[model samples]
Target chain A: MRGAVMHAPGDVRVEDRPMPTIVEPTDAIIRIAATCVCGSDLWPYRGLEPVAAPQPMGHEYVGVVTEIGEAVREIRVGDFVVGSFFSSDNTCEICLAGYQTHCVHRGPGAASGGQAQYTRVPLADGTLVATPGQPDADLVPSLLAASDVLGTGWFAAVAAEVGPGKTVAVVGDGAVGLLGVLAAKQLGAERIIAMSRHADRQALAREFGATDIVTERGDEGVARIKELTGGLGAHSVIEAVGTQESMMQAIRATRPGGHVGYVGVSHDVSLPGLELFFSGVHLHGGPAPVRRFLPDLIDRIWRREIDPGKVFDLVLPLEEAAAAYRAMDERRAIKVLLTV
Target chain B: MRGAVMHAPGDVRVEDRPMPTIVEPTDAIIRIAATCVCGSDLWPYRGLEPVAAPQPMGHEYVGVVTEIGEAVREIRVGDFVVGSFFSSDNTCEICLAGYQTHCVHRGPGAASGGQAQYTRVPLADGTLVATPGQPDADLVPSLLAASDVLGTGWFAAVAAEVGPGKTVAVVGDGAVGLLGVLAAKQLGAERIIAMSRHADRQALAREFGATDIVTERGDEGVARIKELTGGLGAHSVIEAVGTQESMMQAIRATRPGGHVGYVGVSHDVSLPGLELFFSGVHLHGGPAPVRRFLPDLIDRIWRREIDPGKVFDLVLPLEEAAAAYRAMDERRAIKVLLTV
Candidate 1:
């Protein structure tokens, strides 16, 4: 089987690798039908994070179950499924509380990368959510989106408490942020502000229900949000870029007592306690518990209520995995879908 | 009029000062019946925070309304009132949304300084909440507690979402943390863990309905909390100490989906973004919007449902203001009440 591996920063390669096998009683092997390069992948590729060893490259996928362990009762071979980046037992107290990403019985499942021909998923019965039936080819991309970005964006919107009569401001223009606009609209936010400078992304944001666009950064962007919100800042701010500047901007853009739902994997960000203390904003975020929202999101995608797959503007064959990484690294694509 | 003045970090004096007069149309001059030394004031007295000049120092008071400006409508002269450290207009959009501390019309009102014979209160109509009538001398200490520490602790408990069937952990054992225990019990929390090393404070916590007590710090403390909670951490955590260690402990003590409501006046605390991001906890704090809870807290105090004023262990006459500050600084008193 072939899989994507990173030998070092900026060196993603498609190479022959052994096919994954069910090693545990609750494990299952899935034949990947679709996977994609994510915004987070660029972190190591761009050398923002150290790539000390050759590593598996991706964590988002939609696939068909090729084999299932004896203990996996809910999932079986030949079933199409979507799984979250993080696997969970789904029976633990934490999982029962709707925070499956932090399941105490199991560790983060993303360490077992999904960018491969055949990937083994641990705790299969609890992690994988099957579609109603075999999804058609056109539905594959959307289902793949639900594996991470779309569900993550939805979680960000929900954490931000976006709802009727609320004005929401998004602080990033990546695929997750773009989908956040869609989620905010779905949640009935009265106004949506997308902070982006790229023309192409701005257009997509507008199409996805962004009521306004701010092309500034940091203080200027926060000021613009305040101006648009009648000097009180937006009622909710979605932070999809996890940088010091973006986090500060998100905090400043939200009105006091508002919510800041930050979904970006934070890097080099340190918040001064005094500043955050005086901000008077509710701060809640982390790795999205995508498994918690997978069922509903898959249903929404199947009904064609949303089209979040549009974020993948570039598609490449799995053999061209290096080129896919480059496209995302150079900002030439919002997201890249790789065909298996 | 006589007032408490901080000549330097460790020097406090009671001296004659010009009496305050109404400066704004909504301002009121209150003749303080009682005031108290707060834990936050120890920040500067211990030289953790600098005192630039000889500053009037105090923000907690129960007093009689001596005079009211022409525009003051809600409060009248001779009314026994309890007001927060931060005066809010209580009618702005932020106030209407229940964050009166961040009222759009006014910022933090700590500059008014309540440690005086007569102090001017800005936004009188919104900032001051009067009791049913003048109370006996014995209730003065309790009413004064409602002015800040007790209100702050109550807000912390509320923010942490303490309720039936939940486990709550308190990180500080000062007057505020002690009062937080009382608040959690009043909120019907099933179990309350009070972390304290002081025997007196521990005894007070037990009296205030603490179900468990842990005298540990740092990783050891976190380990004890995990051990007591079956390794999942508490459902709610109240942070009453504004330090990196206490903040991190509060964050670590809460479960992934739990809440940390911090009311400590943050000093030099800096939170690592990645740690906070991965923690998956809800974080909110600051100078509590005490005005939002004033009505309910006052009603409870009036009906004798809660006795938060018991936190004050040392009482002194107004002339002994210097001794009051020293007693709190040396940890000889959990809280100091000064009668005017």
Candidate 2:
């Protein structure tokens, strides 16, 4: 099988790799249909994060089950499925409470890079959600999105408490942030403010239900949000960028007693205890529990109620994984789809 | 009139001061029945915080209304009342959202030292809640407690989402944390863990409805809490100490979906964003909109349903404030009541 491997920062190559076998009793092997380059991937590709050693890349995936371990009762071969980034027992107290990502018996859902011919999925029944029958070709990308970005954006909206009559501000322009606009609109937020300096991203943000746009960054961006919301700031703020500036902007852009749902994967950010204390805002976010919302999301995608797959702007064959990484790292693509 | 003023870190003196007057139309003057040295007071008294100038000391009080400005309508002269630390319009959107401490038209409720013969209270109609009636001599201290500590503790418990069948862990043994135990019990929490090493404080915690006790601090305390909760952590954790260690312990002791309600005044703490993000706990707190809980807290104290006044272990005349500060600074007293 061919897999994308990064030997060091700024180095990615598609090469032949060994076939993955089910090592866990509750595992299943899936033949990959499609996978994508995630914004998080850029952290290491750009050398912002340390690359300890050569490692496989890719977590978001959609595929058809090719084989199943004897203990895997729910998932069977030939069934098309979307899998969350993290696997869990699905019956732990944390998983039952909608925090499957923090389950007591959690496993890396994607043991082998999904940007390959085949991959091993642990806790198959708990990690993979079968599509309502085989999804149409046009629905593949959207279903693949349900495995990560769409579900993550949905969790951000839910954590922000975006609801009817709320004024929501989003602080990122990546695929996740654009999809957050869609989620906020779906959640009934009255006004959606997208803070983006890029024209193309702004257009997509608007198309995804952003009612307003502020092309400012940092303190200026927070000021724009406050000015737009009668000087009280937004009722909900979604932080999709993990940088220190974006985190501060998100926290400062929310009204007292409002919620700030941050999904940015914090990096080098130290929140001053004094300012956060005086802000009087609720803070809740971390790794998204995508598994919890996979079923509903798949249903919505199948019904064509949402078209989130548009986030992908570049598409290529699995052998062109290096080009996909380059396009994303250089901001030439919002997200790149790799067909396996 | 006489007031307590801190001229330096270890210097507190009770000296003659001009009588307070209602300066704003929303102001009221009150003849204090009693006031107490708070746990926060020790910060500056022990030089943890700089004594910028000869500032008046005290932000909590229960007293009889002496005079009122023309706009003060809801409260009457000679009525006994309990007041919050921060004054607010009580009509602003923030206040309506139960965040009165962050009110748009907020003012310092204790304009004059509350540990004085008489003090000025801003936004009288919003900050002062008249008790059902004048209470017997024995109820004075308890009613005073409701003005700040009890109200603060109640807000912390509310922020932590304490409810029926929830397990609560309190991370401070001060008056506010002790009262948090009481508030949790009143809110129907199933198990209350008080983290305190002092025997006297532990006894008070037990009296306030602590079901268990953990004497360990920092990581060990978090470990003990995890052991008690089947290694998943508690459902709700109340943080009443503002130190870095206490904050981290509180966050670590809460389960992934649990809440951390912090009310201690932050001094020099900075929370590492990565750990907080990965903790997956809901964090909500700040100066603790005590005014939001004042009415209910007063009712409970008035009905003799709780005895929060027991937190005050030392009683002294206003002239002995220096000794009172020293006692609290040296940990010789849990709290010291300053009788006018």
Candidate 3:
């Protein structure tokens, strides 16, 4: 099998790797059908996140199960499925409480690497959610999105408590943030505001049901959101950029008693206790329990109810994983999908 | 009129002051029935919070409305009422959303020196909740507790989402934290863990329905809570101590998808964003919108269903407020009530 590996920062290479096999009674082997480079991947790729030794890349995947261990019951061989970055025994207490990302028996999906021809998945019955049927080829990207981004965006929206009568503001214009606008819309938000500077992303944001777009950054962005919401700030704010500035903007753009659902991978962000305490907003987010939303997201995609795949503006073969990483790092693509 | 004023750290004087009069159309003058020193007051009195020029101290008050401006509607002269630290116009959008503390027309109740014979309350119609009848002398302390500590504690419990079957951990043993245990119990929490080291405070906490008492502080306290909850942490945590240690313990003691309601007046605490993000806990808190819970609380007190006033362990005349402050500062009293 061939998979993308990074020996050092900015050194991504597709190299031969041993094929993965089910090693646990609850494990299953999946032949990768689709995978993608994530913004999180850029952290180590850009050297912002340290990389120790050569490591396989990619945690997002939509694939077809090729083999299953004895204990795997719900998921079977040959079924197309979507799974999250974190594999969990979804029946665990934490998972039962809708936070599979913190499941007692949780493990990273990148252990065997999803950006490969074949990968081993632990806790297959709980981690993977099968579509009603093998999805149409056109729906593949959207299904792939359910593995992480779309479900993450949905989690952000839900955590933000976006619902009917809510005015939602989204910080960060990445694929997750753009999809957050879609999620908020689907969740019945009365208005959606997308904070973006790029013309292309702004257009897509509008297409995704954004009622307003603000290009200002930092304090100005917060002030603009307040101005648009009658000086009270939005009812819900989704933060998809984990920088201190973005976090403050998201917190400041939410009204007292509002919600700030932040899903961005935070980096060196120290939230001032005084500011957050006085903000009077509910803060909830983490590695979104995407597995919790998989069944519903897969159903939505299967029914063609939402086109989450629109987030993937660039697509490449598995061997072009390096280019995909570059495109995302350079902001040339919101998301990039790789066909195996 | 005589009011308690902090001239400097460790310097409190009950000195003569001009009688308060309704200055705004929405204001009302309250004849102090009972008022008390608060934990927040210690911040400035101890010089942790700045005390510039003999600042009038105290914000918690339960009193009789003696005079009202033309615009004051809900409160009438001779009506016994309980109000919060912050006076808010209840009709504001923020107030209507149940965050009256952040109301657009909000003002500090301490501005007129609540620890005085007479004080002017702004937004009288919204800030004050009238009791069904004049509360008996025995209920005065409890009613005063409702003015701030009880209300704050109740808000913290509500923010923590304490309800039936929930395991609640309280991170402070002060008046507000003790009251939080009572609030959680009243809200139907099955198991209430009160974190306290003081035998007296612990006894009071148990009396207030605390099911368990953890004497350890900080990390050890969190570990004790987790151990008690099968290593999963509590479903709800109320943080009433505004220090880095207490804040972190509250966050760490809450399970993923659980809620942490923090009402402490945070001073030097800085929350690391990455750790908070990974905690997957819902955080919500601020100045308690006591006005939002005033009516319900008043009714409960009227029915004699819960006694929140037992937290006031010391009592003194208005002239001895200096001694009252000293007792609380020396940790000799949980709370001090001052009578006019």
Candidate 4:
């Protein structure tokens, strides 16, 4: 089997590796049908996060289950499935509470890594949600989107409490942020504000349901959001960028008592306790519990109620994985899908 | 009118100040019946916040409406009222959305100090929630509690979503934290964990409905909370202390997808964005919008349903406001009431 591995920053290579096997009773081996380079992958690729050894490069995938361990009951061989970045035992108290990302039994699931030809999905019954049937080729990207970005965006919108009669502001133009616009709209937000400077991304944002666009950043962007929200800030704010400035912008752009659902993978950002305390905003975000939303997202995608797959503007063969990483790192692609 | 003023750090004096009068069309002048030194007042007294001049030193009070401006409608002269630290025009979009603390028309209401014998309440119609009628003397302390501490504690519980079948951990043992225990119980929390070292405060917490008391602090406290919750943190955590350690403890003690409602006046606390983002905890706090809960709190106090005023361990005549501040500063009292 061959899989993407990073020896060092900006040094992605597709190397032959031993095939994965079900090592645990609850594990399932999935033959990768589709996978993609995630925005978070850039953290290590750009040398922001040190890669001590060659590491698996992706965590979003839609695949067909090839084998299952004895304990795996719900998932079986020859079934199409979408799994979250983290594997969770759905029966755990935490998973039952809808936060499968922090499943106590497995810790955070991201450490497992999902960018490979044959991936072992632990807690298969809980971590993987199967589609109603074999999805069409056109539905693959959207289902893959549900594996992370779309579900994450949906969680961000839900966490922000976006709904009818509310104005929502999104901070970031990445695939997740773009999908957040779609989520907010689908969730019934009356007004959607997308903060983006790129012409192409901004156009996609509008098409996805952003009623307003602010090109400014930081305090200026917050001010613009406030102006649009009648000086009170938006009713809901989606923080899809995890930088300090973006977090602060999301917090500042939300009205007092409003919700700020942040889904960005955070980096060196530190929030001032006093400022956050005084802001009077509800804050919730982390490795999104994508498993919690996968079922609904898959259903929505199947019904054509949403088209989040449009976020993947570039697609490459799995052998060209290095190019896919470069496209995302250089901002050439919002998201890149790799055909396995 | 006499008021407690902070001339500088460690220097508090009871001095004659100009009587407050209606300044805004919506303002009302209140003859304070009771005022108290708050934990936040110690911030400036200890020089955590700068005190440039002799600043009026209190923001919590229960008073009798003595006069009302032309625009004041809901509150009438002679009405006994309890108001939040910040006056808000509750009809504004922000206020209607339950964020009166950020009402655009009135701005942050901290500028109107409630310590003076006669204090002018801006946005009288929105800020002051009157009791059903003039209450007996015995209920004054409880009503005063509702003016800030109790309301804040209630807000914390609400923000944390404390309710039936939930385990609630309170991070502070101060007046507000102690009241949080009561709030959690009233909201139907099955188990309330009060983290405190002070024996007196601990006893009070238990009396107020803490099902368990952990004397540990910092990481040890978090461990105890996890141990109590079967290795998963509590479902709801009330952060009544705003220090970094307390905030971190609150965060660490919450289960993934749990809620942390912090109402303590945040001081030198810095939250690492990545840790908070990965924790999967919902964080919401601020100077609590006490006005939003004032009516219900006052009603509960009037009906003798809950006794939050027990947090005030010492009482003094208004002329001895200096001693009241000293007692609270010296840790001899959890809270001090100054009777006018």
User: Candidate 1: misplaced stretches above 4 Å?
Assistant: A108-112, B107-112
lDDT of 4 by residue, A1-340 (tens): 8889999999999988888887889888888889999888899999999999989778888899999999999997999999998889988898898988888876424234566777888888988999999999999999999999998999999999999999999999999999999999999999999999999999999999999999999989988998898788998999998898999999999888899999998898999988898889999988888999999999999998888999999999899999999999999999999998
Model 1: lDDT equals 0.90
What fraction of the true interface does each of the listed models get right, in terms of native contacts kept?
Answer: 0.91, 0.89, 0.92, 0.97
Q: Write the per-residue lDDT of candidate 3 for residues A267-326, one digit (tens) a residue.
A: 999999999999899999999999989888888888889999999999999999999999
Q: Comparing to the true complex, what docking class would candidate 3 get?
A: high
Is candidate 1 or 3 superior in lDDT?
3
Q: Model 3 segments beyond 4 Å from truth?
A: none
Q: Mind giving the per-residue lDDT tens digits that candidate 2 earns over A57-170?
A: 889999999999999988889999999999988898999999999999886778988778899999999999998788899899999888889999999999999999999999
Candidate 4 or 3, higher DockQ = 3
Error of 4 at B169 (Å): 0.7
> TM-score of predicted model 4?
0.97
By lDDT, highest first, what's the ranking?
3, 2, 1, 4
Better of 2 and 4 by TM-score: 2
Interface C-alpha root-mean-square deviation, candidates in order: 0.6, 0.6, 0.6, 0.8
Off by over 4 Å in 2: none
DockQ of candidate 4 against the true complex: 0.89
The best candidate in terms of DockQ: 3
Best by lDDT: 3
Q: What is candidate 4's local distance difference test score?
A: 0.89
In candidate 1, how many Å is residue B207 off? 1.2
